[model samples]
Target: MRDLLPPGVHVAESFGDPPGAVLLPEEEPAVARAVDRRRREYTTVRHLARRALRCLGHGAAALPPGEDRAPRWPTGVVGALTHCDGYRAAAVADATVVASVGIDAEPHEALPEEALGGVALPEEREHLARLDAAHPEFRWDRLLFSAKESVYKAWYPVTGAWLGFEQAVLTFDPAGSFRARVLPEAVVPGGPVVFDGRWCVTRSFVTTAVVVTRPDAAPPAPCGCPAR
Candidate 1:
């Protein structure tokens, strides 16, 4: 999984844990209105984020939520976190060396058919159709959805602007990777940037990530399977 990320980004991960009774001092208030399961998932991922931060030479500190509800990392750090069912993970990077990152994980199962209408663009659907024709085994539609998610994650921090699924065009390859181009209409920093990302299918889940260090750096090559 680390190989798929760009330089400077570090990841931390953990399996499911039963809901605990206490929240770290900084995490308590944010979860005051959350239900038990949401609270448990939130704490577990933050815990993973802290561990990853430490690995990057950062001290453990409360990661608060920003107005848009994204994690507010300590000054000089940019990162993202994700969790699904039994898994949880976090990735962090120095702000100086890397601009932003976005990571996501989903069950290997196919995305529900009905939701595709909202998750895919007409061009993306055509792209998925081609992927489906060429490689019938994997769920290309779901993979496209995941790719868009990673694109959005990396994008929001850079611009703090909303990017609908239709606003970006995504294409995938046979090697478990993807590329995303933001439409010109979207007000991204320094204009639209192409994002190259890697994805892998493990025994339990499909994970994807996008790492951005410079607005003009060339996109990295796609990486292969079993991420995590």
Candidate 2:
């Protein structure tokens, strides 16, 4: 793999696979002056993401309504969407082959350790603390946040079971990338699937990416986790 990226990956990866393209709302200064500042940025990300999906031979048929919401791409296809201050990105693949996919990006900064109590499970908090103890300079908070997000994106598609943040604990190696196992060792109905993911941070931005494959399409192998 090249820098954690694979060869012969989806052609979409060519446009910056984990694509983040922007069509700014800079032209709407008048509308910007009238509406909440948020509407402008939101409009821009949606516009750019839609156009990008269209170029992929999927078009608006591959999009969801809310920018923060997941897309309603073609059946048997999985989709992931992400947005940051000035950019937004999305990914699409066969859903059956890919169990569930989740992608998240956030600015590189220490999230308030004290404030996330409601969302972070006790084991999750401790795991993050251990990671911090091991790597003082690395921002472990981003890892925890991204893990929860990956869990959400992956969970919804498989179990169709909505889970609270504390419902699962994310175990990562060193990067924000990791695997998720739901608590109490409960069966996921269809699977206790392998959640494969990757992430990166540069300058002031941090992003985490994940794609959980359904075992039905790519049956659970003895070796485990062959990334797409």
Candidate 3:
């Protein structure tokens, strides 16, 4: 999983075929309100996240839920968490090295056919179809949706703005990565930043990740935590 992440980032993953235990005190309230399945996923991902932080040299710490329901990391860290059937993972990086990061995992299966229209732009749909025709084995629609999710996760923290699926046009490469061009109206102060992402199909799941570094900010320092 670490191989799929960008430099300065680390990832930890777990399988859920036989669901793991839910043991985080910080997550107890949230888990108590969720159904059995959601509770299992929520707990597993948080566990993975805390472990990743530990590997980054931080001791055990509770990852509280943020205003947007994203995991709030400790100072100096920016990270993302994702979970799906049989897969749960978390990726984290020192904020000085990476501005933000987002990751998502989904079952390697077709998305619900009805969801296609709402989740993809017309251009994106056409691109997916072409890629599908070319590569026949991959579930292009599902991968596109996963990529969009990763884009949103990575975008939100930087701008604190909402991005719909149509706000960016996503294009994929045969090499298992993608680039997203922000639509004109969706441009921020950056005027339009291209988001780079990587995806891999493994262990019966498709996982996608995106990382953004602070190219425009002051030189890297260990004190800034955008996700905090």
Candidate 4:
């Protein structure tokens, strides 16, 4: 996962359940009513997030979710968190060097048939079909889903607008990278319309990440529309 990010970003990741992980007082409310599984995922990711923060020479801080349910990072920091069966990870960077960071992990398996229609554009599906035929070992459909997720994570913090599945066209390279071209309908003034990201498939998971540098980072003047 660390290899997926660019320099100046700090990342921490764990596989399987986090042993002895506990939530801080400020973070407990967010998961107050969550089941054990939810609590575990929440606790583990926050723990890793703080660890990444510490690596950046900052002290530990509670990461509560804002009204939008995105983590409220410390001032001067931009970051992202992700969790999936058997995996939990966090990445953070100084806002001065990195404008924003987004990362996601998913099981290395085919996406459910019904989901592909909603997640992939027609061209993206065609591209995936060709990749699948030539590189049958990779779960191209699932990797596409993960790539879009990483794009949104990077997009939302800057645009504060929803990027629908149909709003972006995606393409993949079998050599571990992908690109997302945000269509005009979803573009925001002063915000990036394209994102370049990387992907990795391990024995158990497929993970992707996007890092947008400063001068093109997020929290751009809100487009005045609520997140959908």
Strongest candidate by lDDT: 4
| Model 2 Cα lDDT, one tens digit per residue, 76-192 | 556665665644554555544565667666666888857577667777778878988998776777766865775677667667666777677777778445777677664466655
lDDT ranking from best candidate downward? 4, 3, 1, 2
The local distance difference test score of model 2 is 0.55
Give each prediction's root-mean-square deviation over alpha carbons.
4.2, 6.8, 4.3, 6.8
Over 1-228, each residue of candidate 3 has an lDDT whose tens digit, in order, gives 555775467677877623444466776776677898887787777777776787567647677687788877888888898988788888888787787898988888999978988888888888988999999788888888998899888998888888898889999997899999888888889533799999988877888888898876554433222212
- Candidate 1: Cα lDDT at 34: 93
Per residue, candidate 4 scores C-alpha lDDT tens digits across 1-228 of 887886678888889666877788999999999999999999999988888888666647889899999989999999999999999998888887787898999999989999999999889999999999999999999999999999999999988999888899999999999999999888899999889999999957999999998864553331221100
The residue pairs found clashing in candidate 1 are none
Candidate 3 Cα misplacement greater than 4 A, ranges: 17-22, 216-228
TM-score ranking, best first: 4, 3, 1, 2
Itemize residue pairs with steric clashes in candidate 3.
Answer: none
Q: Which residue runs of candidate 1 sit more than 4 Å off their true CA positions? A: 18-22, 187-189, 215-228
What would the per-residue lDDT of candidate 1 be over residues 1-228, giving only the tens digit for each residue?
A: 565676456776776753542457877889989997888889888877777778556646788788888988888889998888888888887787678898988877789888899999888889889889998878787778777888899998888789998888888878877889888888665744788899987856778999888656455333221222
Q: Give the alpha-carbon lDDT of every model.
A: 0.78, 0.55, 0.79, 0.88
Worst 10 residues of 3 by lDDT: 219-228
Please tell me which model should have the higher lDDT, number 2 or number 3: 3
Q: TM-score of model 1 relative to the true fold?
A: 0.88
Indicate whether candidate 1 or candidate 3 has the larger TM-score: 3
Residue 134's lDDT within candidate 3 is 94
Clashing pairs for predicted structure model 4, backbone only: 158-218, 158-219
